[model samples]
Target: MSVPLTLAHLVWRMKHVHPGSEVVADGTRLRFADLADAIVRMAAGLHRRYGIRQGDRVAVLAFNTLEHLQLMYAVPLLGATLTSLNLRLDSAAMVARADRSRTDLLVVGQEALDHRSVGPAVRAAAAELAGHGITVAAAAELAADVETELPDLREDVTAFRFHTSGTTGPAKSYEVTHRDVVLHALSQSAADASGLRAGDRVLPLVPFCHVNGWGLPFVAALTGASLVLPGHDLTPARIAGMLNAERVTVAAAVPAVWFDVCRHLAELGTAPPAALREVLTGGSAVPRSVVDLVRDVLGAGVATAWGMTETLAVSTYERADPSVRAGRFVSLLEARIDGNSGSPGEQGTLQVRGPFVVGDRDGWFDTGDVASLDEEGRLAVHDRAKDLIKSGGEWIVSAQLEQHLCTHPSVSAAAVVARADPKWTERPVAVLVPRQGRLVDETELRAHVAERFPAFWVPDAFTCVERLPLTPVGKVDKRALRARHADGPVLSPDTPGGTR
Candidate 1:
């Protein structure tokens, strides 16, 4: 007889091998053994109370709290699929995701329901969900003391329903099986990957709604790494305190969070926690400055990861010099540049194939990124295919230009968007956020870009702004930039045209 691979085995590991492992969230701490019991009880309660069965979809709208974490394991253990709705999304988008996933039950965290900005959206989603014959309940009311037997499930059973961050366009939904989750978690646990292990206190600053907190929760369960959920208070101060107070050895978040945390630590004159060993960041390109700050201020190695919702969080991790390359492919994954004929120097759309990856054609998933792969299998993503600016039939990579422009002393952030021009069909336009208490000039910025790039690659127009708009996931909102600056530059106080 063959033994099946399922999350049930992970729960078993929690009960037997790592019973004493801790899970801290919102000032409450629980051992793995206790969490396992709660998971089983919650699974039973969900089944008995809501009649949730195999193939049913349970949607959760909440922050990174203990209750939210419990539902991640509980809903799936009952052979039901867990659909995590992005609480940061607007009410319409949240409802659309729930409706698209065919949610049979909706669990709203009490904190979410009480939130000022998210409350209205949750109530709106809940009201609409109830109208569609879906059972809606508060997360606080779902826990049960009832003891019940868990069901055995196949590895191929759908365990999670995830949606893309929709940074470029509308959000798209996808499903991951038990096999995918287990394999991805195991792969991430490897020494070269996230290097998760027992005794490590892991804090996932990434939201659970975002690819299951970038799969850290499950990795913690599998490896016996104590999980420290950040809960709703994502302020950099709070995260910084938790790192030292909880003795976190491993942490993960997007580049934006790390940048703020670095500043916060500098403000407080605090050092990186002694126990902290590594920081995993991605979601968008990890700037070299952020990587250097992590190493210099946090005194930890930075794993600049690259992956998407379709690729199961992060597929590759570059640790040594993260800013230059995306990283070598992790175990159980493969990558190739589309249309590249065996030349590592060739650039094309990045396509990946892996056991856990979702692909549209054949088994290879087109990553929508224009990238080049070195002989060592390292990936250098140039820019998103849609974001590339074509001028006089020559493509100008926006990400490269943006990175170079940000290196300027007075610029804190930069985004390069394509502007329509009758002469060249399209020209590069730059939008920059000046560093605090600093002002930049269009002439100096133009000269800065012209130094490295060709004259044509230099942006035709430059605009200074107080801040760049961001997507729900914290990536620079280039789409919005294009729309806002399509015709001409929008002058701000810092803009050369306005009084500085």
Candidate 2:
């Protein structure tokens, strides 16, 4: 007889087999057995107090905390779908996503309700959600003294409703079944994949709101990897300290967060935790500098991943060797480069299909990335197809240019965007943030790009800025950059207000 693949099995395995595994958050550490009890109690409370039942939706607006993690499992155990709201989004955007979820209850975390920057927005969103007849309550209210038995849940029932990062367009929502969560977790824990195991102390610096913390929470429960969740205070100094305090073995976050942590370590003349063995980074291309810093400073190997909210946030993983290649596909997932499905070294749009991967009506998901496949089927993403600049019929990959520019000694971060040009149709322009106490010279930047890339690929103009804007999920906000350079007198490096 075959068993259904659901979260129930994962919970059972964690409680029975890995009861000693702990989840650390904000100075609180709860072992697997204790966490299982919490989930049971929380499920009972939701059922008895809020009347949350099977097929209902419960949305959470909180950071990565013990309470948030409990709700992640408890709502699904109650046979209700769990929805997460992006904390970085504004009040209106948050309200829109909450409305779209048709949430029966909204649980606002105390930390979020108390945050200065995000508190107002959370309150605004809660007020609007409550006005819509959706029951809104504080996250602190999720507790009960009695433990209740979990109901039988089907494998195909929707467990999570996730929103896309909205990097290229408006954020979109997708559903993942219990089977999708379980199978993805099992695939990620494979030796050749994320390699999460029983002894590994995994740190997910990524927000729970982002692809369910890149699905690491479930992988931890399935593989017995202890989780070290970085709560709301994501300061660089705080994160570096946690890495040492927790003795983290496998840490995951976007490239920007890693960069901050590396900088913090460098400034303090400190070393990364000796147990930090691997750093899993994605969201955008992991720069070669970041990979080098992780190895030289953090004493950790870098695993560059390629995934999206649609693909469960880590479908491909590579050892990164300081290269931007997105590694080969993991088990259960398959990809093709446009029309060149099996051909090696062919470049085109990347499309994927798999049992756990979400797809359109045609059964294949177009990733909207211009990519190439190596002889071993390893994937290398060039750039977003829409972000590529076409000048004189030649394509200029903005991601490649930005990565190359970031390698310059004077540059800390860089972004390349397409500027409308009547003569060439579209021209590449560079926005740069200089290293501390350094200035970026446009001529030097041009020479740097022309040294490796073709002469025409060199950005036509360079604008020096203090920093590049980022999307809610922390990828470079190229849409904002393009809008800035869309109609302005192309601001020169010498412009007084260029930094803005």
Candidate 3:
């Protein structure tokens, strides 16, 4: 049997199976049917009143909320693609993305009133679209009474356009089909198949702009699960309070958010929240310390995910081996191992090719990440194939540097990147966030690195930051770091120079 990609099937299933169940807690209660009805009505209204149609791209400029989640259902009702616009990106990037998607409409909510209206690029696109006659809707003014009927979309129609952070470079755009979205929704449902039962509350701290908000909305809608949208203010205290008060059983976040919230809970003399059953962390490697925090502090298990926007959502997950279960980790997705080009315990790139993995090579969609797969099938993401530092033409894993820092007593967090140099072509640099308000200088850090690594592999420079700038999705904003320090002094291969 083949799965047909359509919101209709999901809505019907939910309405029949658990219609009266609360599907979303967007600061208010709404049943799955209530939400589905609203989506159908809006999709109808937009199509009839404003001529919104399928195949056209609809950009949403709001944070994670009930209305934003509604768009996921409503847009596809009209056969239109949803482009979840990142709120943290500049107006310029937004416009560029919108233009790239040829966005025909943008739906924004009232909570966004404090923000300056459509970005200049959006304004320009709006002006251009208006010249050709297009409709842009503000939430307060939209009504579901319009009488327009929407057409059924083709099975393979594109449903969304996801954008990469361009953290390493300029962000690239990719289109996700209705099939991709549907498959992602189903895939994520499988991940939630463990301890979470129907109606279990799952708090989503991840932003909605990313890969269908990592496909959270779809999973909840289909599974008759409840969703708690935490808006844009992601303070650790706020999330911690929600977890405790709401008795949220499951949640998803990047390591950074997890770290901060865990810190807040610890400060309050609390653990990872007794109500929390499982925590899904991704957006980079799962530090050994983080794994320990999730296990010891929260008394919960951790599942690490791997993927990119192009994959629509997760392709790999960290799980424990069934037979051994001796605290050995494993990835559920299809994977293979390759050469490490480093040292012992340091393995090679974990190459993968699966239906969910997307990238173009000759014709394949390579994920561009170099990783390692243990005998147990656990995947440790080493570095971006493009970002790996090559010293004397031998690869120096930057992730290894970060892993070393995470284990250090004084370090709270670290990001290691390659600096372009004339001699080695590129060398490592360590940008860090210290733990417990510790003050760490360059000499002290270099000395620390020298103790663990060969002198040549030591970072040529160290930049201490109050906090690493994060992308909208909450990963360290390495792009911002390079923009600030790309012109910093270069170290000579002949001597160690970052001493002052």
Estimated TM-score for each candidate: 0.96, 0.96, 0.85
Per-residue accuracy of model 1 over 1-500 as CA lDDT, tens digit each: 78877888888889999999999988789999999998888888898888888999999999989999989989888889998888788888888988744788999998888888778988888888788778888887887679677777888889998888778887788888989999888888888888889999999988898889889988888889999988777888998989999999999988878888887897788867889899998888877677777888899999888888888988998987787788988899988898879798689999998889964525888889999998888988899998999999998999999888878887766789998999999999888777657777778888899999999999887787776787777777877888898785557665353324
Better by lDDT, candidate 3 or 1: 1
lDDT for each residue of candidate 2 in 155-221, tens digit (9 for 90 to 100): 9889999998778887788888989989888889899799999999999888888878989999999
Model 2 local distance difference test score: 0.86
The TM-score measured for candidate 3 stands at: 0.85
Error of 3 at 407 (Å): 0.6
lDDT of each: 0.86, 0.86, 0.68
Q: What C-alpha root-mean-square deviation, in Å, does candidate 2 show against the real structure?
A: 1.9
Off by over 4 Å in 3: 1-3, 115-133, 140-143, 146-150, 191-196, 270-272, 293-299, 319-333, 336-363, 420-423, 441-452, 489-500
Candidate 1 lDDT at 28 equals 89
141, model 2: CA deviation in Å?
1.9
Say which candidate scores most in TM-score: 2
Clashes of 3: 9
Model 1 score (lDDT): 0.86
Q: After superposition, how far is residue 335 of candidate 1 from its true place, in Å?
A: 0.9
